[model samples]
Target: MIDALHTHRPRIVVIGGGTGLPVILKNLKNRHVDIAAIVTVADDGGSSGILRNYINVVPPGDIRNVMVALSDLPQLELDLFQYRFKSSDQFFAGHAIGNLIIAALSEKRGGIFDAVQILSKMMKVDGHIYPAANEPLELNAEFSDGTQMSGESEITAAGKLIKRVWVETNDDSHKPEAVQQVVDAIMNADQIVLGPGSLFTSILPNLMIENVGDALKRTTADIVYICNIMTQKGETENFTEADHVRVLNQHLGMNFINTVLVNMKEVPPAYIDHKKWNEVSQPVKHDFAGLRAMGCRVISADFLELKDRGAFHNGQEVADELLNLIGRSPDEE
Candidate 1:
C-alpha cells in the first residue's frame, strides 16, 4: 500500500462487473481519486459468450462497457466502437464492434490483460482497467437444493436459490491468478469498492480468484460495498441489505467488508416495470441493526435514481459517500 506520507491522490480500486460497475466509474471520473477497475471475466451470455466460445478469450462485454465509461474518446468514435450489428446482418450479427476488436487484440497480444492495456491507451481511458484474471473464467455455483450450475448466464437463467458461488479455470492446465498489477492496485488503494452488481455472478466471481481475494484480505485499504438498489430473482431474491454483506463475508471466510453504502430512499409504488427488468424482483430491504451487528459502519442516504421504469443507484451520490469514507471531497478536483 502507498504510505500516508506520499503526496499522491487517493487510490480507489472498484471491483465488479455488469452495467452497475460502469455507472460508478463514470460518476467518479472527474473526482480526485485514482481509479482502477478489476472487472469480472465470468460473463457467459450475449455477444461476449458467443465470442468467448469462438476464440477462447475472456468475455469482453463488461470490459468494453467500462472502457466506454472511462474513455475520453470523441462521442462519434466511441459510438462506432459500441455499434452492434443488426440481427439481419449475417456472420457479424449480434456482435459488438468493441468485443470483436478486444478479441482480435487478445489473440495478437497473447493475453487479455496486455490487450486491454494497449486498448486503454488507444481509447484514451483515464483510469486503470484490469481483468480479474489473465484468461477466461467459468462461474460455478451450488444451489440450495444440492444442484450445481456452471456459466454465468445459465446460473441466472436457472432461477435457483444460490448457496455458494466461485470461479474456476476453463482448462485443467490453467490456474486462477490475477496479475500482479491487480494485486498491487488492491494493496495500494485507499478504499476498495465491492459492487452494486450481481451478488453471485458479477462481484463474487471476481473475488473467487485466489490472489485477488488474498490481496483484498491483506490490503490496508478500507473495503466498501455499494449495496444493490433492488434484489434480483435468481441471486438475491427477498434478501435484506445485511444478507448481501453476509454472503460476501461468507465467500471470503471473514468479515472483511468495513463499510456499506446503502440507499434508504423508498421506491414509489408502481414505478418498477417488472417486464422490462425481468431479473429485478423488488427493492432491497434494509436491516441497519443487522448491518451494525456485523461490525459494519453503515451510511444510508437518498442515493436512489428512478428512471426508464426501473430503480438504480445515483452513482454520483454513492461516489460522494465513498469519497467521504476516505476523507476526500468529490469537489476537490
Candidate 2:
C-alpha cells in the first residue's frame, strides 16, 4: 500500500518479453508512473520465427504485444491490427496483422529499433517500447548435462535443465547490444521491474544482452522482480520463487534485485487445465528466508488471478504495489 498519495509521476523501466510483460504494462497504463518497456528480441518461435527466417529481421511478436498493451488507439483499430489469420487461410496463415505490419516497418526503417519508435507514434503508444537489440539474435543455452542448443523454442523443448543462457547474432559476430535509449532509460529510471515471464527463455534473453545487463547492474534504481505464480515445465520445473531470483543474480554476478513481489494466493489443484496451460508445472513455492538472506526485501501478497483454468498475476494489484514502492521504505515490506 502507498503510504501517501504521490503527486509526481515516477519513471519506471520494465524489462522482459513474452505474454506476462504486457499484463503489468496494461494496468500501469492507468496509473501515474511513466513506463519504458525493453522487450527481448531473442524469440525464435511461431509467426515471429517464421517471419525472421524469411525476412532476416528481428522478431516483432513480443514488441507487437508490448505495443498493443501501451497503445492508446481505438479498440476496433487495435483489434483489427491484432487479428491473426486462420491457418486455413493458406497464404497468410498463422500470422497476426500487427506482426506483419511491424516486420514491414522494420524493413522500411532499416532496423527493428527505429521501426518500433516509428510504429509507437502511429499506434499512439502510452509508453516507450524498445527492442533489446537491433538484430535477430539466437538464444543459446548450456544444459546441466553439458549439452548446448540454440533457439528459444528448441531449448524449452529439449526439456533439459538450462545452466545459463546467452544471445548472439546469426553468424559469429560481436556481442549483441541494446540501443542507447534502452540503456539510458535504465540508468535514468527511479525503478526497474523484471519478469512475470518465463525464467530463462523470456527474461534471461533480454538481460543476457551485454549493454542491458551492464545497465541493470550499474543503475542505482531500485530493481524489483515480479516472481511468476507457477513453475514452468521445461524451464523452471519445481522451482521456488527464491530459486528464480538466485538464477537471475548468478547470471548478473551480483545481488542487484532489491525487491521481489510474490503471489500468496493459492491456485486450486483441480482448477488447472494442463492441456490448456501446458507450460505450467506447479505452484511456485515461497522462500522468504532465502530471499531475505540474499538481501532482497520480499513482498508477499495475494497477487494471483485465476483465469482460463490457470494461475496468473493480478496485474492491477502488482502495478499498485510497484507504485507504492517508488521512494518508499524497504522496511515497509
lDDT (C-alpha) at residue 310 in model 2: 91
Indicate the residue-level lDDT of 333 in model 1. 67
TM-score of 1: 0.97
Please list the Cα RMSD from the true structure of every candidate, rounded to 1 decimal place: 1.6, 3.0
TM, every model: 0.97, 0.96
TM-score of decoy 2: 0.96
Q: Please give, for residues 1-333, the per-residue lDDT of candidate 2 as tens digits.
A: 133324446789998999999999998885767899999999989999999999998998999899999999999999998999999999999999999999999999999999999999999999899899999999999999999998899999998898999899888578888889999999988899998899898899999998899999999899999999999988999888889999999999999999999999888999999999999979998899999989999998999999899999988888889877885432232
Q: Would you list the clashing residue pairs of candidate 2? A: none
Q: Which candidate has the highest TM-score of all?
A: 1
Report how far off residue 280 is in candidate 2 (Å).
0.6
lDDT comparing candidate 1 with the true structure: 0.92
Instruction: Candidate 1: list runs displaced more than 4 Å.
Output: 1-6
Cα lDDT, model 2, residue 143: 97
* Winner by lDDT: 1
For candidate 2, give the lDDT of residue 26: 97
